[model samples]
Every structure is written in C-alpha cells, then in structure tokens.
Target: MSQQKPPLQNRVDPWGVLHAVQARGTLMGNRGILHDDQNRIVRHWAGKAWLSCVLNPPFEQKRSPFSQGTYSELFFLDEATAFAAGHRPCRSCQRGRYDAFKAGWAAAHAASNPSADAPTWLPIAAIDAVLHAERIGPDRRKRTHPSALAGLPDGTFYAAEGEAWLVWRGQSLRWTFDGYQRADAPPAGDEVAVLTPPSIVTLLRSGFRPSVHPTANLYN
Candidate 1:
C-alpha cells in the first residue's frame, strides 16, 4: 500500500481548497500568513489579495516553503486551477500577466465606462474587492453559481460529482494536482455549478488566456 505523505498545508486545488498532495505545482501563490508555527493551516485566508505567481520568480528572494514569513506560500498546478481558486496573477512576480488580467477585467466588466477613452488601468485592490465578494458565499465557503456550459469560455471550471473540470474547446478536462485529462464535455446548453468566479469567467470571455500545464496541449 502507498504510504501517506506528511502534511505541508501548501497545495491548493481548483475549488480554493488546500491539501497536502505530493504533486508538481506549476504556479506559486499566497493569501497572507495562514499557518501556525507548526505548519498547520489555522485560517482560510489572512487577507483579501489572493495572488498566483510563477513557480520560480525571477526577482524575489528565494525562501523555504516552511520558513516563517510575511505570508504563507501556496502552490497550484497551473494558472487555470489558480484562477478557479479565485487567485489573480501576482503583480510583482507576474507583471505582464497582471496587466493582461487588468486589461481583461476592463474589457469584461468596465467596457460600458462612459469615458470613450475607457480605463487603461484598474487597481488590483479594486479587482480584489470584487473577487473577494464573488469567491466567498454567505455560508462562508467557496461560492458557486450556475452557468450555461456551452457559454463558459475556455479555462473556466465547474463542479461535478465533487470534482473540478476545466472547459476547453468543447471538451471537459478533469483537473488534477498533477495534470489534466480530457473528458467528454457536458451536453449542449446544460447548466452546471461554475467554480470560477463570475468576474473571472467574464475575463476569460474577454480573452485573458492563462498558462496551463503542458499536458493540456497533449489532450487538446
């Protein structure tokens, strides 16, 4: 029998859930300091700005995952999973992606801005405010909403049988901490529990493509 791995309290899943899986994570992230001195998760989040970053940040000083820090390090399999977990790109480590996210946001939700010039930039904190509201429900859990499957853009995720599946080019990819597997897409026009936040879903609809694991192309 396979033995259980020790707890790291660092791996994040598509539903914004944390686990201790021993799989490779392609992205790094944080939600402020969430662990105790003994490396146990003591809170859901320490702050509102949940951010997804690169596995190896080019500029930031490297530190041990277990090192005591200003924040607890969180890891995700890919940007798609991270977005499903309500995380946006880290402004510092992923500047280009962050700008694209803002541009996408402006195009998605602020297109109606009366100003013909529109907004060239939207504050990350403002986006965080909206995401915070959408990511958490009144029941204080990962909020879910219903959406038409056929209408969801690629990279969007939905809940089915308690697992998260990514919508990609008319196919559903089963998300795993290791990688994704192609699966039958839902029937045309079926409504499912959308796991990605509404605002971010709109962002995908606006073409802010996220980086996915290489296996995605394998199954594509």
Candidate 2:
C-alpha cells in the first residue's frame, strides 16, 4: 500500500480575504515569495501570481556562504503577484541579457531630444530623461523624493541595528528597506548610517531578533 501526503493548503492573499488561493508550497531567495502547486511553480507578491517556467538565475556572487544549494528559479503566483511583490524584471535572464540590453536601452533614449537634466546613474539617467520629456495638462506629483546620498564616500558604509548597506566607489549608495519609510536623510556629518541588509529586514519583520532564540530554517 502506498502512503498518501496531505493536500497543499491555499495561501491567504495578504491584501484581502476575498483574493485567497490554494498554494502547494514556497521557495526562498533574494527575490520574493515563490509558491508552487505540484505541476508548476508560481511566484506571488502583493496580490498577484505568475507562471515561473522561465527562471532568472541568481548571480554567482549571490550564493549563500553557509548554505548548500544555489538559487533555483524565480517564481510567482501570477504576474500581478510578482509586481506587487516589488520585483522588476530580472537583470540576468529576461532583459536583453542584462548588460547589452541596458546599454542599448540607455543609448536609444539618449538619442531622443529631451531636457538636459542629469541623472546620478548614466543608464537610469537616460531613461528618466525620455520618460519625463513631455510637459502638458495637469500638474504632476512626485511620490518619493530623490535621495542623492552625495556625501557618503566610497568603501565606507554604516551598519545599524536594522539594515546593512554598501557604499560603492561610483558615488552610489544602496540600502535595503525595513518596510518603514525613512523620513530624515541618512546621517549628517561624520556619523555613519547603519543599514541592515534585505535578508536581515525579512528576518526582523518576521519577529525574530538578536536576543531572541534563532529558529532553524529547515527548508534551507
């Protein structure tokens, strides 16, 4: 006689009760939640899910230090779920092989006639110019303010109780979000801005802390 496994339960859509669905299981990665039924893996974010037949593999440097396996496929419950999950297109597989694709995208936008405003990053700057070229109709509103992070020197970074960040040599600063929006600028003067990494953010949000006992993530 063969043993039987319990049927997978449906995942409750976090946004609303009416939007729930049965989910088989979940996979973890740098990206968001990857849920699956026995037949196909799906990634879910916000309230959406997408078919994950195509996997955007993680970069070599993105592997875990103490863990065993490399990153598997990027999955989602649906396309809306992926976007709501806050993932853009993968920098590796989907977008013109990443490098060439971004380069061409930047160049094409640069050729168009537009304002002379400069962007902090070249490729992103070019795209911004093209997107904001038109000025007509009602007054537009900006959501998030531009954070220049102009002063933080390269190689120097801050580590706070909440986040981990790296200040690159290219005058760019990258930090993970803690779900809470920061109102003030990073830090003034010589005080270093301690930034927690995304993994840390995920853990903290889940209610674990340094003083509290750590739970083993058996899935890993």
Candidate 3:
C-alpha cells in the first residue's frame, strides 16, 4: 500500500495550490471550521475573516494538529503568503507584529487621505472588512488587481502565466512549497495581477518587512 499523507499535508494553500512540506508557518486563521467528517479541509471556506496567527500558544493545551476541531489548520509559505491570502497578523500571539502592521496600514491610509479629519488609527474590524472583499470575489475566485511589478516591495506575490511568483530584490521567483525558483521578471511598466491586498502592499512599500522562506536567499 502507498504511504498515506497527513490530512494537513493535503490542505490547500492560500495561492490555490496544494503541497506536502515540513516548513513551519508563523500564522494561523479560520474560514468557519472547514473540516469534513474525516477531518479534511474542504475546497470552500465557510465565510470571510480569514486570519493570520502565530504558530503556537502557551495557553492552549497540546493536541493533534488539525484534528477534528472548530477550525481548519491552514498553513502558508510565509507571512507574505498569509497576507496575500487576505490574513492579518494575530493580535494574541503576534501582538507586536500586529501593532506594527496596524500602524503601517493606518499610515498608508492617512498618507493617501491626508485630510485633517483622517483618523490616525484604524480598527481591526475595519481592516478585516476590506480584506474580505479584496481576497475573494462574489464568484469565490481569488481577486487580483492590476499593479506595476516595480512598485511592489519585496515579499509580495503575484499571479502570472497561471503560476504564483514572488517579488524579491528586483526578480520574480516562482513559488513552491519546498522553495522558490528563479523566474522571469515582469517587464517594466507592465501591470500584473497582484495577490496581496492593496493595503498590505502599501504597508510593504512603507517598509514593513515580512518573513520569507530560507530558499529565497539562494537566488539572491
């Protein structure tokens, strides 16, 4: 008999790809408890509010990862992938990162607004609402907006030629569960479909650095 794979290994990633790898992720989120009777994540998310989180918490008891539970245990390639999948940093385990992300997000908006009445802070709920709309569409496909590749900061991912590519130091690296591979850079002035949310992109452009896979350095 063939070796059976763990259910979580079969889970689909935010980029609409499936893989089995050992790289640990730093974030977690919920899409309304999407496990089946056999504890497999189904194709569709139950609702909005896809979240980002830290890997583990001291308060929670140890249990089987992705066991039959209220929420499915989804993993990402990195923080950039999590953001691309429309997740923000978790406020509990990743409080400091969350605060920084929130501050960057608010600053991005304030710079764009630049009005005397513009709020200096934005509520998490408000950010989630915007992400919900940007991450998915009425048809449930991953929503993407046209953006210049040069304008995107490092750690962002975009869809091109039906594959996901990462932006890193002026190059586009093809994304994989194991690592990223070298790929063609988008031509100057070309507008490609951006997977990461506009606000998160703004935060990245504003110098909010996100963690990337170690393999990302091989090409650099």
Question: Against the true structure, what is each candidate's TM-score?
Answer: 0.90, 0.25, 0.86
The candidate that wins on TM-score is: 1
lDDT of 1 by residue, 1-220 (tens): 9988685878999889889878858889989989888888889788789999888777656777757766888999999999999999988998988887887788777653547676667788888988999999988799998988877899999988777898887788888888988776445356899999988888888777778888887864
Query: How well does candidate 2 match the true structure in TM-score terms?
Result: 0.25
Clashes of each: 0, 22, 2
Local distance difference test, per candidate?
0.84, 0.29, 0.73
- The Cα RMSD in angstroms, rounded to one decimal, for candidate 2 relative to the true structure is 18.5
Per-residue lDDT of 144 in model 3: 86
In model 2, where do residues sit more than 4 Å from their true spots?
Answer: 1-67, 72-74, 97-115, 120-220
Q: Which stretches of candidate 3 lie over 4 Å from their true place?
A: 1-5, 9-27, 185-189
lDDT by residue for model 2 (44-128), tens = 2222112122232444445421132322234233322222222223444445423443444444333432457622235433433
Per-residue error (Å), model 1, residue 102: 0.9
